[model samples]
Target: MLQVLSSESAQEILSTLTSDPGTASEIANSVDQSVQNVSYHLDRLCEADLITPTKTWYSQKGREMTVYALATERLVVQFSDSTD
Candidate 1:
C-alpha cells in the first residue's frame, strides 16, 4: 500500500478523483496521461484499496465504463513499535 501511495501518478489520480468520480479515460485526461498509463495506476490503486468502482456507465458506442472514486476521504498511517 505504501509503495502504491508513493507513486506520483497514483497521487495525481487520487487528487483528480477528489473533485469528481470518473472513468479511466476521464482521469487520464484530467491528469494529462495516457489511458493505458492511467489504467495501470488505477489497477494499482484498486489493489491498494485506495480507490473503488462506484458505478458503471456506457459510452455512445455501448462500451461499459467503470467510474472510480476514492474508497476513503482520508488516510491515516501509523507505525508500531517492534519492541512490544
Candidate 2:
C-alpha cells in the first residue's frame, strides 16, 4: 500500500476518495484536475488493487446518474517500530 501511495497524484486522489467516495468527475473537481487526467490516475490505482469502483445510481438535475465508491478494503496500514 505504501508503495502504491508513493505517487503524489495517486496519494492525493486516494486521500480525497477516502474521505468520501466519489466518481472520476467528482474526484477531478476535488483535486482540481481534468476528468481525463483523473481517470488515468484512477485506472492506475484500480490496477494496483488499491481501489475499487462500485456502480450506483445518483439523482442529479432530476436525472439518475451512475457513480462509484472507493472500497475501504483496499486500504492497509502497517506499523513498525525501530530505532535508527
Candidate 3:
C-alpha cells in the first residue's frame, strides 16, 4: 500500500477524486496525463483499496466507462516497530 501511495501520479489521481468522482479520461484530463497512464494508476489505486468504481456510465459511442471515487473520505497511516 505504501509503495502504491509513493507514486506521484497515484497521489494526483487521489487528489482529483477528492473533489469529484470521474472516469479515467476525466482524471487524466485533470492531471494532464494520458488516459493509459491514468488507467494504470487507477488499477493500482483499486488494488490498494484506496479507491473504488462507484458507478458505470456509457459514452455516446457506446463505450463503457467506470467512475472512480475515494473509498474513504480520510486515511490515517501509522508505523510500528517490528523488532521488540
Candidate 4:
C-alpha cells in the first residue's frame, strides 16, 4: 500500500477517500478527471489494499454503485532531513 502511495494519482485518490466514500464518478467530478482515469486510480488503490468498495444503492437511479473509501485512518509519509 505504501508503494502505491508513491504515485501522484494514488495519493490524490486516497485523499479524496479519506474525506468520504465515493463512486468513481463522484471522485472524477471532484478531481476534474475522467471516469476512466478515476477508475484506473481506484484500481491501483484497491490492489494496494489501501481502499475498499462498499456496495451501495443509488436511490435516485435505483441502482447499485460501488463506493470506495480508505481502509485505514493512518497515512504513511516518508521524508528526508539530511542536507549535504
Judging by lDDT against the true structure, name the best candidate: 3
If candidate 3 were superposed on the true structure by all CA atoms, what would the RMSD be? 1.2
What's each prediction's TM-score?
0.92, 0.68, 0.94, 0.77
Model 4, 1-84: lDDT tens per residue? 667777887777778878889999889888888999889989988888788887774858687778888888895667777882
**Candidate 1 local lDDT, 1-84, one digit each (tens):** 999989999999999999999999999999999999999999999999999999999999999999999999999999999997
Say what the RMSD of model 2 is: 4.4
Candidate 3 collision pairs: none
The positional error of residue 47 in candidate 4, measured at the CA in angstroms, is: 0.9
Clashing pairs in 4: none
lDDT of 2 by residue, 29-78 (tens): 99899989888888888887777777765666665533545666465576
Error of 4 at 58 (Å): 2.3
- In candidate 1, which residue pairs clash? none
Report the alpha-carbon TM-score of model 1 versus the true structure: 0.92
RMSD after Cα superposition, model 1: 1.2
lDDT, candidate 3, 1-84, per-residue tens: 999999999999999999999999999999999999999999999999999999999999999999999999999998889985
lDDT (CA) for every model shown?
Answer: 0.97, 0.75, 0.98, 0.82
Better by TM-score, candidate 4 or 2? 4
What candidate 1 gets wrong by more than 4 Å, as runs, is 80-84
lDDT of 4: 0.82
